[model samples]
Each structure stands twice: as C-alpha cells, then as structure tokens.
Target: MTDSQGQTPDTRRDFERFYAASVKRLVTVVYAVTGDLGEAEDAVQEAYARAWPRWEQLVAEGDPTPWVRTVALRLAVSSWRRTRNRVRAHFRHGPPPDLPGLAPDHVALVAALRHLNPEQRRAVVLHHLLDLPVEEVARQTGSTSTAVRSRLMRARRVLSAHLTDSPDTPTAGAGRPATAAQPRQEVLPHE
Candidate 1:
C-alpha cells in the first residue's frame, strides 16, 4: 500500500490522473473568470500545488475541483485588485516629461521617435540604439523577424525624414517632437 516514503501509491496515482484530466479545463474556466491567461494560469497552478499535500483527503471527500476552483478564483480576484491599485498609483504621477538632450537636433530626433507607434519605436530603439539584430528584436517583441524588419524599414523612413535638418523636416513635423498618437500618414508623404 505504501511506497518508499510510506505514501500510498494508489493515492498518488489517483491524484496524478485527476490532475492530468482536469488542469487544462480548470485553467480555461479560470481564464474565463479572470480574463487574463497569465493570471489564470498562476492562480490555477498555485491552487493545484496547494491541493497536492491534501490530495488523499480531497479525493476521499468526493470531487476535489470545488476546493481548487474556489481557491483559484479568490486568488484571481486578489491579483486583479493588486493590479488595479498599481495602475492607479502610476497614473497619479502624471505624464512623463519630454526626453531631454544637450543638442537641439538630438532632442528633436528623440522627440520624433515619440511620434512612432509603440511597436515601431521599439523596433528602432532595440535595433539601432541597442544594436540588436532584427531576429533578436523580433524575439524580444514576440513578433516574427520579417515583421520586425518591415517595422524597422518604415521606422527608418519616418525617422530619417523627421531627423533631417532639410526643408522637408521643418514642414513635415513642424519643428515639434512627435507623439505616438500621431497618424503615420501625417508624417509620411502620399505617393
């Protein structure tokens, strides 16, 4: 009845079977309630870990799911509350100040970068400033290398047009740093 450590083999096997059959479905239900895959996964895994030490009792008392589900859902609610509070605290700091620099042109370049969409800005910074390859950048951003390359190309055209001191720069961006919210067409000339 007992294994090397005096734990019953039947109890361990039964718990393993129950876990294999239920974990994915449990996570799906928890994700529906939590609306975040990562959070749901964390909560459900923690619940299962907690249940392991109590497996014999849980299994003998009928289905162990209700116990695990209740614990996981409660943890999800706690996680949501913590996240909401952190967001509120961050917004209280107000918007960040504009990027600073010694040279006006450098400042202007940094400002122009702000106008790019978040994905494009990341592609430029990671590739050009950090000198990372396109494949590495794509890996960091969870995108394919081809998509990252395209982003870098468009970003370069946009940045090159924005960074120049020529007449195009003065008229195109109006001597102001770009914000991420600006439309790309506003900065790019129509072909």
Candidate 2:
C-alpha cells in the first residue's frame, strides 16, 4: 500500500514484523506514561491502529516507534484527564468507598505527587525517575534544555525538602540518624 505521502507503506508481512518487534517496547513506554497497565495497553493499541494508515509516511521517516509513543502518551493523558474529572465529581458528591490492599506508603506517595504542580511532577518523573537526558526530555516536552534542567533542579530541591520533613524521618535528638528505611520509589512518566 502507498500512503498520501507517496511512499510505499508496510505490507501485511511488514506490519506483522513491525508489530512483533515493537509492541513490547511501545507498551512499556505507554505504561510509564499512564501508570495503569490496562490503560497503557489500550492506548498503545489505539496508537498502533492510527499508525497503520500512515505506515508509508512512518517508514519513510524511518522508525515509527517515537511517533507511536507520542500518540499513546497523548491518549493516556486524555483518558487520565477525563477520569480525573469523574473522580473529582465523586469526591464532591459522596464519600468514596475504600480501596482494599492499598498500602499507606503508596497513599503517601500519591499524596506527595499531588503536592507537585503538573509540570514539576512531569519534569521530575521524566528526568530523575526515567533517567532521560535533559535534551531528550526537552524534545518530548517541547521545552528548552535549559528550562528542563531548571525545572529538574527545582523539583529535586522541593522533593528533598518534603521527604526530609516527613514524620518518617528521625529528628536530631533521636539516638539514631534519620533515614527512610526504604528509599522513595520514583515514577518515571517517560521511559
């Protein structure tokens, strides 16, 4: 098949090969972005579907993985935004039912994430948690490298302060030195 871009798109055999090669990596990126396995799978599938018609354009550009990832992340973010509104409405209307098997530490971590503004959280996750270089993050986020670096610096400072002040940390007067038993788990939004 040829695409509007006047390039020969992938044939059935080519698509099969591509899917077999790329699905796992694409899903991993989606999972990192969405933080929900089910949603990540759905989003990645959707992106793959969209990419199908544009296969020629993608193949011509060489390596469609990044394009697929961008689409998946966008879809995941859209879904998250919609769900967030529903959650807010549920909170306002009535008491929420308890979720079972939710660890307190996990709850605390989510709360800590909520404390950060979205950009700061994204910067922290993309850089520190994902181990992406500043340039890559800047490219993904459409920001200058310097801006990404600045945001990462600010995020680290804020996170450090927040962790240090948490009740889990020991005070100077305590016989033992203050250190969290388990290091905080960082969620990388883009990996």
Candidate 3:
C-alpha cells in the first residue's frame, strides 16, 4: 500500500520506527538547548513533521539522526530568538514562576544550567549530556574543538558553583533558615 506521497508502507514504518526510537532523546537534547522542556518537545515534533516528507531521501543517503537533530536545534534556536525579547521583558519585571512537578535536583540542575550562556550551555549539553566528543560537538556547533573545550570548561565551572549550596542558601521548602553546610556538589565535573 502506498501513502499520499506514493511512499510504500515500509517507508512509513521506517519513519515511524525512527521516530519512536529517537523522539525522547531528541526532545531531551532540544530541551537542553532551549532550557524549556515544552519548547523542546514542540520543536522536535515540528522537526519530525518536516522530516516526514524527506524521509526516503534522508534514509537513502545516510543516517537521518544528524539531520533531525540539526532541524530540531535550528527550530529551537528560531523559537528562542523570536521569544527572547518577551522573555527579557518578563524577567525585567519579575522572576519566573516556580515550576511544578519537577524534582528539586532537576530544578536545581536546570537553574544551574541557566547560568551558562547559550554557547556554553550548548557545549555542555552536547558534550556532557549527549555524550558527544569534543570534535563532534565542535562540528555541530560550528566551532573549533579548542573553542568547544573552552566553553565546556567555563560552563562546568559555572554549573559547579551554582549547584553548590551554601549554608546561607535557602533550601527549597525548608521552614528553617538553611541547614548545616552541605558538601560542594559537582553538577558538572572538570575534564
């Protein structure tokens, strides 16, 4: 049986299989890129939708992982650019509302991640979270390996500092002032 694009059922199945296998990972990667899970999921879904038409060609040429990732990242970047002004304005007036249904550690990690600039965050996510080599990250980010290394170093430092909770730092829900000094947490380790 052929679909509207004249592609066989096997072609549709291939795309479906690819989507099922990679969608979660793609969303996670895009979330690290966008610092917003909702936006990441939306961007990845859109990217997959776009990829549907070119599935056959993408499959014929090579693995479509890079293509889908690139498209999702690009879509996320576009969305970020469009919303940046609004975000800045919102922040100027007040802090972001607390997110519900997320673990404290997850919230802390994400908050620490926000301290990094886009380049640094992207480098950290690509190299550490995604387990890509520095060379591959450099290729993906269009930077030299040295640059990626530098960004990773800086990002790790920032994340380390941010994640480490000082005695003065208020605990998320603790009624008391803060507990005893906690050990310095290493959210991102040095290379």
Candidate 4:
C-alpha cells in the first residue's frame, strides 16, 4: 500500500523495522522519565502500538521517533497523574498507618521522601534508587546535566539533613549536613 507521499501506507514491515530500531533507546529515555523500567517500556510499547495504524502518515510527515517519544512521554505523565490521584484517594486519611514490618529508619526515610517535591523526589529516585548516571538521568528527565546535578546536590543536602535530624535515621558522616557551597569540582555526568 502506498500513501499520498509515495510512501508505503501499510505499516507492518516498516513498523517492525522501526520498532526494532527504536525500542531500546525509547525505553531507556522513558525509563529516565518514568523512573520505572516496566512503566517506561510499557509507555514506549504502547506509543509504538498506537503509531502502528498511522505509521505511513507519521513517516511521511517526519521522524516517527520523536512522535513516538512525545506520545510515550505524555502517556507516562498521564499514567503517573492517574496513579497519583488514585493514591491520594486511597490515602485521604493517611498512608495506611505505615506497615508493621517497616523499620523506624525506613519509616523516617519514607517520611523524608514524602516531604520532597515531585521533581526532587524523581531526581533522588532516578539517580540514587535506580542508579542511573547523571547524563542519562538528565536525558530522561528532560533537563540538562547541569540542572540534574543541581537537583541532585540540593536533594542530597535535603535528604542528609532530614536523615540526620531524625532519631531513627543514622548517618555515616560527622553528623553535619554539607552546606550548599562547595569547593569547585566537576560533577560526573555518568556515575
């Protein structure tokens, strides 16, 4: 099948090639955005699936990659918002009174995480929890590496303070959080 642009209107073969070429990179970027590998992969896959029907049109227009990227990102954000709303509704009273097996330190850490803004929390999760490099984190989060560095620096400072202050939270440092000011040093983009 041919489209008006003289491109193949049928997407199966082209879509297969496109999927094989783009899936990994898309999943990586989406993972950075969603901070969940499963969610990221799902979003990208869903985006590609949606694009399948319009593949010829998308390719005729321009790069299907960016279109897929945008759609996947929007899907991720929409899913996040929906999940957040559900959690809010579920915890209208509170966070289920905390789990019984949760250690005191864990509870305090969870509390501190809850105190952080969404972006800060994401910075923490992507860089720290998920162990993504700063550059990858920046790419996924749609921010510059410098911005991701700043977010991590600030988030670390806040987490350190929060942990240090909590009786249950223990610290390996000298019990003092580092000031925002620091000796000039290059931040590692990939660590």
Which order, best to worst by lDDT? 3, 4, 1, 2
Q: RMSD (Cα, Å) of candidate 4? A: 10.8
Clashing pairs in 3: none
User: What are the Cα lDDT values of the candidates?
Assistant: 0.67, 0.65, 0.80, 0.68
For each candidate, what TM-score against the reference?
0.42, 0.58, 0.79, 0.46
Clashing pairs in 4: none
Give the poorly placed runs of model 3, Cα more than 4 Å off.
Answer: 89-101, 166-191
Runs in model 2 lying further than 4 Å from the true structure: 1-10, 87-117, 124-131, 157-191
For every model shown, the clashing-pair count is 2, 0, 0, 0
Better of 1 and 2 by lDDT: 1
Candidate 1 residue lDDT tens string, 30-83: 554443457779999999888888887888898897678667766866786689
Best by lDDT: 3
Candidate 3 C-alpha error for residue 86, in Å = 2.5
Could you give candidate 4's per-residue lDDT for residues 61-174 as a string of tens digits? 988876797688779768867788654554344334645565666555555565566577667766775577999778777899998889888877777766654344343354
Candidate 4 has a TM-score of: 0.46
Per residue, candidate 3 scores C-alpha lDDT tens digits across 8-41 of 9999999999999999889878876667877888
Better of 1 and 4 by lDDT: 4
Tens digits of per-residue lDDT for model 2, 1-191: 65564445436558768989988766755544444556769988999889887776787899887688778778877887879875456434432235345465543343444445556666666676567788988898889999988887776666555444345544433332224344667998986
Off by over 4 Å in 1: 1-6, 85-191
